[model samples]
Target chain A: MALARWPYDDLFRLFSGQAGPAPRETAGVFPPVNLYDDGSVFLVRTEIPGMDKTSIEVTTAGDQLTIRGERVVAPAEPGASYHRRECDGGQFRRTVTLPQPVDAEAIEATYKNGVLEVRLPRVPERKPRKIAVA
Target chain B: MGTQVQKTEAGTQNPEIQVREKQAVTREPGTWEGPYFEPRVDIYETADALTLMAEVPGAEAEDLQTDLKDNLLTVSAKVARVDPRWKPLYEEYSVGHYLRQFRLGEQIDQAKISANLKDGVLTLTLPKAAAAKPRRIKVTGG
Candidate 1:
């Protein structure tokens, strides 16, 4: 799938100032996603492990697809202290602009084993007609 | 740590292994220097072993490597590159190598380490050493 660089990435970085050889990828985002286009449809797969199915929401509007979800952080066991807290749980929103015009009604989405996959079929190209001799 | 002297028929030899222990994971913000993304991990401690679950999306099972040496454990995995035919349009997640490490305690049995990858999640089980397990002794009335 054709993915334009998230325009706000640089702006967010400006304030985050987490600059270095490494970028803070998950400082705010919850689920990481992979998007691709194969000349027919744009496919998106996101990793949302241990998330309830009902919390996820997928929507499309004005050539843009938005995925919003919330991941609840599980309560710690009694008398337990965390040694490491790398994973994060909270509400996350990701909106991607479509590379080409697509049939909005033909979109298909599925979630399995904590991975969410969405397929957006491109609208068919119109054939050019030959002009009659004048 | 200095090596212990072992007496043997064929002269004295120092077979004692020298092990360096790193401190346990602490909540020291900004301790991670350099430029590298930290993969998310979940640690579960049980009576038998400590289970570690790391999220390494887009990584293949064969491409992951778990190494342990001198009480320092490292987990690294190579994330497969995207298809060259499709150009990046809008990207929120940067695809690159996944690297994370931990310093295991002496209570762990390094010999029985096990790892498995499924649905982009890597699960590692570090069994506890026999001496680390809790034991109950019977007491008789004196």
Candidate 2:
């Protein structure tokens, strides 16, 4: 039997023989994300728990934004025994291609309560042109 | 109505039917804590293979124990909540015992069962016995 791994197949069928959503491939590290549009900007919220701010790195280029972070498993609590562990740790990366062009210079990111929110502002020049008809 | 709670010649009650009864009664205890605290689950089932999802959150590996006695499959786990110096603002979630019981029916291939957990999700795959699985006969060609 074959085992699933990172950078997995795009069109793989699960045990139910049902195909999952199309594979979203962009060169980078990041888990599933939600992007919201607020008319003039885009807000991307990513769930990254148990990670400190120092371990995260963010950047925006053209219409593409990438967020990279790592969560190191702290030294086992003193006198702690292994039972069951269920949290996802280690390094994570995500690259998102926005639907509309964004102003790379004014992009902003904020982290709170283990969630990373990235905001991409729209360009002043492309801010809905208005003119009088001759 | 389809539940097999009726008496049979074997004298003892069918465990699978009892488990279904218990599942229907409890529904989801401590469910009023809102929708965010959802415990991940995995289910494996078949026509005869009784399905069960083991929820053992906050329980260490060693504390969890699963045993089948007289057709009753009992799953028990314990979770201890330690409150440090920091006080909780609005704590609705509670940490306590995580236990569930099921009466398993025959035709369960318990020996070939598999369990694994990833990202807080626990999955158990229980394959059915040879006689329980749906099989098709091969036709011979001339």
Candidate 3:
């Protein structure tokens, strides 16, 4: 049995027969992310609620992708006091190294329901190619 | 006197942000088939009403459901699953539904309760009942 750091990771590993937990720490980082690869493209997703689209900035340089944004929470109404406060507002920046070089010009990003999805298409030469036998 | 709430000033050195992982809550058997997460919530009290804000990313507005029975309020959202073709390479967070329940301690006007979902945050305003609202009694000169 593999020692899984997270229950979801365990479930995925069980199905895929993969070993070892993710390399990065999941809890300490701001705006945790999920990265996926599908041969031709890679998808990066993050959840950042209550942020304006203009406030978010995404950029890619070589094999590194960076995401920066700020979340501004409105001050409490006058004469109002907090009973429970868990959500926070602040600035955050995260950078992840891609497994392979990508076509940065072709990348596309979309944000919906507070989820940001970035699609990075792999460079043509890096993609797997099929060969014919004579 | 009004309570003072500390605000994170802009342009100052920002504090390190920590990720808030979703928590699983115990439920009776034969409930929803898939696992659900407890969303983080903020509750504030004013003279007229109590406001609740919850973070439920990837949840559609139509998929959110809220129930108010007596003093117990339950909020739940069904998040759409990702496409199966994309193989997982690295994952730091899991996608799942959101569910949370709150037991109200004050009398709330059930009919006046209203909810709105924006940018994956659910805002609920629970107005206080007439008897629950604070009132000032005039002291006449003796």
Candidate 4:
């Protein structure tokens, strides 16, 4: 007999009820995500918990961006224990595909408050202009 | 916020117990505690650049420090939990240390990294390097 293995993505899919619209039974997904455009770069932000500053990894490929990290909820020192479990603890992989071609050479990502943010720069374009004298 | 939460190492336990323990474990409203912790953050994107705002309700300027190293952004802050100035019979918020990490992309200019804190909110701005700016290139053909 083999035990089942589950990651945070699976848990998120389950929480989102994407597998089947069963009205998600478990608590909501951890680290909600937000995407925004900064004219120059597209920004993606995610919420992650109990993670060290060193555990996070950010990389990009063409139009795709990925953020991988682990969340260790365990603390070295202890004061009080858990009364409720709203926060999720474990590893998280968040990848975002850009809508258009982006400058892989000029991407940026930042993390704070257990949240990871990635910024992808847009590729420059060329245009034709028409000039006329008044 | 001044309640104590006990850890249950047992394999099988009630879910309600886990939930209550997390909340009652501390005596502060805006503090970080326990193994499973999450912080709500707001990301603001503009044409020029992007700004990340975090709610560190009671954290002071000096207590917070941010660094962007090797494309990884790290934020660490500590709050003094005990102060004898006022006597408190009850507390709903507990102050503790906070540390968070982020993996970054290349768009962030390694040189101009700046951070500012105001009204319990920490804002970090990542500027685009000059080389990355979009510019028109003239084309000539024979």
Best-performing candidate as measured by TM-score: 3
Interface RMSD of each: 13.1, 17.9, 3.8, 18.9
Give all TM-scores, in the order shown.
0.62, 0.41, 0.83, 0.37
TM-score of chain A of each: 0.71, 0.69, 0.75, 0.63
DockQ of 3: 0.47
Candidate 3 C-alpha lDDT tens digits along B1-142: 9998555446667654556777866674215567688889899999999999999999999888888898999999988887878876778888888999899988999999999988888999999999999999899998
Q: Could you give candidate 1's per-residue lDDT for residues A1-134 as a string of tens digits?
A: 12233445543553477433323233233344555666788887666655677778999886788887766656545544355655556556666666567889999998654567788888888889899999
Kindly give the stretch of ten consecutive residues in candidate 4 chain A with the minimal lDDT sum: A21-30
Error (Å) of candidate 3 at residue A112 is 0.8
- Report the lDDT tens digits of candidate 2 across residue range B1-142: 6876534335433211110101212445632231213332234444534444444444455555566665575565444443232221111123344455556555557787665533222345556678877678899999
- Candidate 2 matches the true fold with a TM-score of 0.41
Tens-place lDDT per residue, model 1, B1-142, is 9898733235323221111121222333322332234567887666677778776656678878888887788887766555676533334456555677788764889889999876566788888899886678899999
Q: Name the runs in model 2 displaced over 4 angstroms.
A: A1-30, A125-134, B1-34, B37-142
> Which CAPRI category fits model 4?
incorrect
When 1 and 3 are scored with DockQ, the better candidate is: 3
Off by over 4 Å in 3: A1-27, A126-134, B1-11, B140-142
Against the reference, the lDDT scores of all candidates come to 0.64, 0.49, 0.82, 0.51
How well is each residue in A21-131 modelled by candidate 3, as lDDT tens digits? Answer: 443447356788888877899999999988889899999888888888878887779889998888888778788777678998999999888999999999888467799
